[model samples]
Target: MLQKAFKRYIDSFRGFSKEIWILALITFINRTGTMVLPFLSKYMKEDLHFDYDHIGTVMVFFGLGSMFGSWIGGKLSDKMGFYKIMIFSLLTSGMLLIFVQFVTSFIGMCFAMFGIMLIADMFRPAMYVSLGAYAKPENRTRAFSLVRLAVNLGFAAGPALGGLIIMGIGYKGLFWVDGASCIISILIFATLVKEKKLSTHENHEDTEKAVVKSVFQDGPFWIFLFGSYLTALIFLQLFSTLPLYHSEWYHITEFQTGLLMSLNGLLIFFLEMPMVTFLERKQVNRLKLILWGTFLLSLSFFVLLFDNWAGILIVSIIFMTFGEMFNFPFTNSFAMSRAPKGHEGRYMALFTMSFSLAHITSAKLGLGIVSRHGYTTNWLVMGILGLLSCASILYLKRIVAQSK
Candidate 1:
């Protein structure tokens, strides 16, 4: 059955020709470096002995830079071309990682992560837009799903070994590995991938411009983005809050926390593509699955609140992972299908902003939830909001139709 589903996913990509495979390989390599993320904080905190507030400060700059970079990256891809933008971003991301290896102070570290994230996020939308442009309509969803699965495959192994690298090789070793991965990814993309972006500047020859006139000006796009960002706000807490709750509240080991994240990635690695292919073929409504997926994702937080139990937390995370499988890939595919005819770059750029904004607030929002209402209430509120995102997606659909 697993092999059968895998074949369906590949078959779905029948008309993609060769461009899509090259992009997938590039994505897989770039993401492999990122998989080291699950433990970077723990290393900084326990080994370097940084305080919680300091870590938050570091994340703030990272978030701010990412938002700015992602917006610019999307437009640049639309104007200049995906391949060019990716080459620049990939090369920069690796250099930034090497820079981060040398930074020690809070401000310096913040700048490093921020710089890398800004560059990394810029290439993200172009990649998404390129996939849609490179593949056939029927294959688009599967292509996104396939790409997601490839990302998780790297993520699954990267973190598990990251823990060992932190122990045996030290934190600097992990950074070096990540830097090398980025270099490799950039080289592969520069050599293998080839996708041109649309020209943004009509009068300026071929210079890139914003995908559309003030992309944020679109009412539906912003609304959908906000709704999605809200989910990311809650979802991101898993990294920070989950460990604290598990270690202090649930008494789960530090090692176990890392293991749990690997488990999440593992589930995503094996199941994501198959689930996407099957779900795409089913008669079920797309919006409904998105809502339910968000709902399940929020439920992962709920288990932490229940007597701070590890078992429940594990199960809840599984639920959230399942939900992620349902929402994220399909959301990209659906957004692409609904994008305005001549504004693919603008469409993907604005869409990517939702998650960027969320990453900015995700940690602080999660911490705020715990401080004000306690973990349980915050998780419950987030879960309810996840279901509501369904309503928002549906509402956006109506808005799009009205515009049409």
Candidate 2:
């Protein structure tokens, strides 16, 4: 039975195209080297001697850059194609990462963070659009999960290694490594993957039947984005505020915190593909799964309310990891499905923008609450937000069903 289960797990990874595999590899390399983010808040506070409010403000600029990058990347992908944008984003952002470490003042750091992220995050929507070009329709959701697996796997390694780098040569080492990795990942991609026209893979049936409505006109899609925004707002706390909580509340060391963060990635690495495969085969409603995920996310934060035991941190992370595994892949697939053929980049840009917006809000709001009220109050606020997100998705499901 164990052998059979293992085979099944392996089988879920089969059948992807060569391009998809290459994309996944690039994602892995890029994310693995991109370890600066998981510890950025801590770096600001401890290394730069910034207060919580300053860190939050810097992060807001980071998110603003991400938002602008997503919008531009998606627009350019439709016009110039995903390949050029991907390469440009990686190369420019890699160079930026190396220089960002030199910026010490609060204002300088904020601009540095924003500029780096603006270049770096431009890769996101373009990458998503590339999957549509590369993966077969039948295998698309699994393809998203495959890339996500690479991301999580990279994340699993990145943070643990980052912790060591910090302990040894300090945070400066992280920036150097991060910059090199981005350049390396892009080199691999550029050498192996030739550019293809975005129109090459367009589904004629999809285009012919597609209404081509403006993203703003799509009511259900807007509802879905709002739900996603809220879910992301809560989930992003894992990276932003949670690391500080680990130190201040639990007295967990930086390495210990990295390991804890790594657990989220490890769980997604092992379980996300198989779970996504199983659900796809079962033909489950994506929105329903998303609602369930929102519930888990909310519960994860509520679990943190029981702050006495360190073991509770493990349990809370488990819930949050499961929430991520369920929420993210389906959300990607659903957003892709909603896009009309020619406007895929626009739709994807909007989808990614929701998360960027959430990233903007998550740090400032979460850190603000922590500075003023405390962690317990912040967690409670996040839990309530999660519930609201769940309700939004539930309503979205009904709207979709009635429209169908």
In angstroms, give how far residue 91 of model 1 lies from its true place.
1.0
Clashes, model 2: 0
**Worst-scoring 10-residue span by lDDT in model 2:** 201-210
User: Which one wins on TM-score?
Assistant: 2
The residue-by-residue lDDT of candidate 1 on 1-404, one tens digit each, is 97877787565555554877877877777777775577667766976678988977877777777887777887787677777777888788887786677777777778877888888788888788778667665566778877887787777667767778877978888888887888898797777755554323222211112234555566666676766777676777776666777776678787888788878888887677667667766745555677677777766655556673457867877987888888888678656654554556667776777777887776677778888877777677777667667678778657655654
Candidate 1 backbone overlaps, count: 2
The digit string of per-residue lDDT tens for model 2 on 100-194 reads 88899999988898888888888999999999888887678899999988887888788879989999999999999999999999999999988
Question: What TM-score do all the candidates reach, one by one?
Answer: 0.84, 0.90
Q: What is the C-alpha local distance difference test score of candidate 2? A: 0.88
Model 1 Cα shift for residue 21 (angstroms): 2.4
Please provide the root mean square deviation of candidate 2 (C-alpha atoms, Å). 2.9
Candidate 1 residue spans exceeding 4 A from truth:
1-16, 42-51, 196-214, 255-259, 283-285, 299-310, 400-404
Record all residue pairs in model 1 with backbone atoms less than 3 Å apart, i.e. clashing. Answer: 79-208, 81-197
